[model samples]
Target: MFQYVFGIPFTLLKFLLLWFWGTLKRLIPYALRWKKSIANEIVLITGGGSGIGRQTALYFARAGATLVLWDVNPDGNAETARLVRDCGMKAYTYTCDVTKREEVYRVAQRVKEEVGTVFILVNNAGIVSGKQFLHLTDEEIIKTMDVNTMAHFWTLRAFLPDMVRSNQGHVVTISSLLGESAVGGLSDYCTSKFAVRGLHDAILREMSVLDSQVKCTVVCPFGVSTGMFDGVKLRHEFLLPFMAPEYVGRKIVQAVLTDTEVLYLPPYVQLLVIAKTILPTSAQLVLEDIIKLNEATKTFTGRRQDTPKKEN
Candidate 1:
């Protein structure tokens, strides 16, 4: 009756309901004390130099975990290591371009030699060019796929066997909400994220089949406030809030410790997934338009190209 009286489509009402449900989710309390599970775990995080990876490392450091950080940037990796050590935890950094299988293998050997054995693996390294499909160069597209999709496979292959043998480990894959809902400008980025989602799901299925104690968590978050995509415009804050890297990091750490299988962050990003089930094709298009998501890349230039404009 409200929908009819307000002349709003049923789909909008459903979207609103889901949004409200997501907003209220935090009010529903947890059943158990989960924080105690994390102490003294050996955690290896890829892309641990910055953004969510860097933030998660700090969380684990504070929680008393031995840290192994891998990233292409030696400077960034070193900074993260310094910060973790400042937290009074054991931390190590290595320059590893996760896109290459051999690099991951080499790093795995070192991590095993130094840290003993990795008890948790966080595949969080990702790159985004933010170009439209037409403007995306071949190199850019390949780089996106290599870092976002193939890296997950290589990192997991390098670490999973040890996890399986030990029968206690956690694999956390940080995929984006864009994986489920693909937008226009970010074709390559979205494709890679979507593929990683499938990879994570397959891993979960394998774990379930073997009845393994190795837990897996696939994180699907919306736009993150990290300067990775510095120039990209965000249309809405609350409905699709820019997730803080720290918030995502804390969530991932909690999931790894507590044995959660999949974690959709901010708790509300899952509502976008549910939207696909209930919204009509045309209505979905309208919703996307309202969000201004597909065209978000129009203003994006990334960190390298984002030169500040000077007043005349």
Candidate 2:
């Protein structure tokens, strides 16, 4: 009993010291602009046909990584591959709907046989209905969940085993700020993002238990100009400006190279997450009203039907 009691203070002190050391380690790399090279890495990106996915593929191509793009739209996927080829890097495209589990497995096997094992996997494909709870059709809700949430599970299951065995890989999850703090007019979308965020955290924990070197990053950014949230608007643009797709893509590549665990674009979004956790329910509602978070998506038109879906 005496040893346990006396050890408490020592334990707390050790914890604080370790926390400081970890913070210092993170800062040193940022200060030095240090990033690991991904040259010759095999990168597989879902929804790589458009928006952030396409932009990220371009960035990786510039870094000498071979890209394998999977998307439901053949035209957009082909265009992305063409762009990568223009960069003088190898690029392969496959038309596969991520929402289908069997299709994902089949395509994943083909990628293994044809392109080689993926060293980095970006689960960037997503869709948003931008509909209110009652207004959302059952099909729309299911589709949102399938594309944004279940698709992660399918891809991870198909690829993570090889990564674990090799002890080398990176997994990137493109979530949303709405996943951290919910608002109105996008119940289905918010639900999907939140689910993915949770899944990402769980994967991190499991990876730690397995003592794996495979890194995981989950990104939560505000509305980006990716066409997925085309008409969405924020009341205070100065407080939280809409991010450009290129900027987001660049940041995501940086995070993966640096092995950043969790990234919040604009950075201040992390403060909002803290506020959501600490504030009272009424206070939170008032803050949301001021920011017009609930009304921001009222004007959301999303992607046009004729165009390929914007996968971020």
Candidate 3:
């Protein structure tokens, strides 16, 4: 019993030392070199018909990667594919209803047969119903959850087996800052994003435990200029402005190339969580009210019943 107790300290010390070294390596710029190449990768992006998804597809196509674009909008998805082909890269597109699990699986099989195995899966598709908790209909809430969170599950189930077997892949979840911090009038949207973060983290840990080479990245950006949050007003534009789609898109591609784990756009967005933890609950409530995040959606006339691509 005495020897077993003594071994605990040494084991903990070793773990700390290794963790410290890992952190130091990550801090060094030289350690971030690409361990995998995108030039030959087959990347599948959901909601790729427009906005950030389209921008990301463009970036990857420029990098010489093949693309499979999936969207609910036929014209938008075709346009994304055309733009990629214009870049001298191959692109295939499908009109898919992500809320339907069987449809996700069916199209995934079609992709495998036609586009080869996807080396990267970007679950960028999401829906938002900017409404007060009491104002939302039951269908709207369920639809939001189905597209934003449940669809992630379906895509992973359809594609992850190949990634697991090969032990080489990347999963990118385009979540939002609201996932971590909640505000009024965004109950349905927040609920879906919050659950998405849960799934992203779980997949990351599960992959680590299995000793798989698969990597997971969760991107949490504030309001973006993707039309989905077009009317979102921010008092501090420089510090907390709505990010441009091009900038957000490029950052996502960079994260995947460098194997970044969690990326909060503009960097300082991480401080929200820090403030919440350090401040009292009353103080936190005051901060949210002062930022007008609660009222940000008051004038929200964003596209109603809009799919991610539909906002384009």
Candidate 4:
């Protein structure tokens, strides 16, 4: 009884100290700005054909990292490789459907043999069906889960072992703000994003338990100007503007270099997450209504049929 009494206070004090230290770290711009070099690191990105993935690949290329791009669209993948090479960096392209486990493993082996081990694996491939729950078809739901959630498992299974063996690697998961908060007309998309978030968190914990040096970062951004959510609009644009692909790309690269574990783009989205946790159910509904959360996706005309699906 005496030990418990003393230990509880000590733990509380420790928590306060840690929180203060963390806040201080964030406040010190110079401290956070110090970034590690990725020069010559082999960086592989799924859905590198266009949008955020392509932009991120370009940034990594500029940083002197060799890039391996995987996508279902050969033409788009080739275009991305061309852009990387235009930056005076080496780039290899492979056409692979990330949703297929066998294809992921096979292509991964080819990457290992031809391009060498990937030091950074960016699981950025994702698709969204902007339909109400009842409007969504079985095929659409399955494809959404397969591309957004199951693909992560397949790619990680194929490549994470090497990272664990070498004890050096980084995994970046491109989640979304919807992953943290549910909204109407995006039930399938939300389900997949939530699953990936859970997967990323579980893997992070496992890495911690194993004392592994491999780092993981999960990015949750608001609606980006990427064609995927082209017509989607937030009710409060001034407070939460749709992010540019370039801005999101640059921030993601910065996060990787700085070893940031979780990133909420525009930063203010973090406050919304906090609000969701603290507010009662009725209060939350009121808040969502005020924000017109459900209406935001009412006009969501996703990427065009002719356009290649891009990373979120």
lDDT of 2 by residue, 66-89 (tens): 999999889889999999999999
Q: How high a TM-score does candidate 4 get?
A: 0.92
Each candidate's number of clashing pairs is: 0, 0, 0, 0
Candidate 4 root-mean-square deviation in Å = 2.8
Every candidate's CA RMSD: 9.4, 2.6, 3.0, 2.8
- Estimate the overall C-alpha local distance difference test score of candidate 2: 0.89
**TM-score of every prediction relative to native:** 0.86, 0.93, 0.91, 0.92
Task: Give the alpha carbon lDDT tens digit for every residue of 61-140 in model 3.
Answer: 98789999999888989999999999999999998999899999999999999889998999988877777888999998
Quote model 3's TM-score.
Answer: 0.91
Candidate-wise lDDT, in order: 0.81, 0.89, 0.85, 0.89
| Poorest lDDT segment (10 consecutive residues) of candidate 2 | 1-10
- Quantify how close model 1 is to the true structure by its C-alpha RMSD in Å: 9.4
- List the candidate 1 regions with Cα displacement exceeding 4 Å: 1-32, 306-312
Q: Which segments of candidate 3 are over 4 A away from where they belong?
A: 1-14, 21-35, 304-312
CA deviation > 4 Å runs, candidate 4: 1-18, 30-32
Ranking by TM-score: 2, 4, 3, 1
